[model samples]
Target: MKTLYIVRHAKSSWKYSGINDIDRPLKKRGIKDAHLMSKVLNKMVDKPDVFISSSANRALHTAVIFCENFGFPHFNLQIKRQLYSFSDGYLVKTVNALDDGFNSAIIFSHDHGINTFVNEFGNRPIAHVTTCGIIGLKFKEKHWKNIRRGETFLVEFPKNHK
Candidate 1:
């Protein structure tokens, strides 16, 4: 079995009006929530073998915080522009390209994309994947390429702790 974490990028800052959406950084609340979610994930299960995120600033920052808490090196995180898109098929392709040697992975992305990605691999209907939320899925397939729908094992949202 292989495990995957579908994470919504942490809350972003709207403080800078002229800043591009892709360039927007995490807000203070986002930073706090990232740490909180990381602590929660630390107790959930074995750490993911790899971390991946959209190259967008908010998503990448969120991934970095989570990877730090998970004790994963920065070099292990993969950044893909496709992850910023809401295309479910593209997200699947990204996951399919992973090395079979890695048993688990965490993918940080934006709202609609994160929501769509989780539903692809889960039995439940997740209306929204809130910022810093983590949805865990465990597939029966041995290889990432064969991963399909599986049991939704976990759902952790920042509000749940607040």
Candidate 2:
């Protein structure tokens, strides 16, 4: 069976007022939350075979921290620029294009799309997925393209722990 972990990028800082939305860095709270969530998932969730994240600064930073904590190869993570669009349809297309070599994948991106996609593919309803939030779904099928709304195996975020 294929498995997927949908992750919302950690909170971003607006301190750099002139920076574009795509270039905002993480806030201090975001950094801590990312660390905590990474550690938590490292212990509880199965390792993902692939790691994909939006090329935006905030999401990319979160994915880097997660890869370090999860022991995933740093170079293996793909920074996709299109994921920044935050569109569920685009995200699904991205998933469908994934190679079958990996049975599990970690997809990190922004909200609205992540939130919408999760509610679509996840059995449990979510009002919103907080920064650094992670929801794990277990697909009944073995192929990525055949994946649909499967079982919600885990729903975790930093607030729940701290």
For residues 1-162, write the lDDT of model 1, one tens digit per residue.
888888888999888998788999999999999999998999978888889999999999999999899898999789999887866776788888988998988888877766777887799998888889999998999988998899999999999998
Each prediction's TM-score versus the true structure: 0.95, 0.97
lDDT of 2: 0.90
lDDT string for model 2 (1-162, tens) is 888898899989998878899999999999999999999998997789999999999999999999999999999999899899767887887888889998889999988898888888889999988999999988888788988888888999899999
By TM-score, who's the top model here?
A: 2
Count of clashing residue pairs in every prediction: 0, 0
Q: Note the residue pairs that clash in candidate 1.
A: none
Report the lDDT of model 2 for residue 153.
Answer: 83
RMSD score of candidate 2 (Å) = 0.9
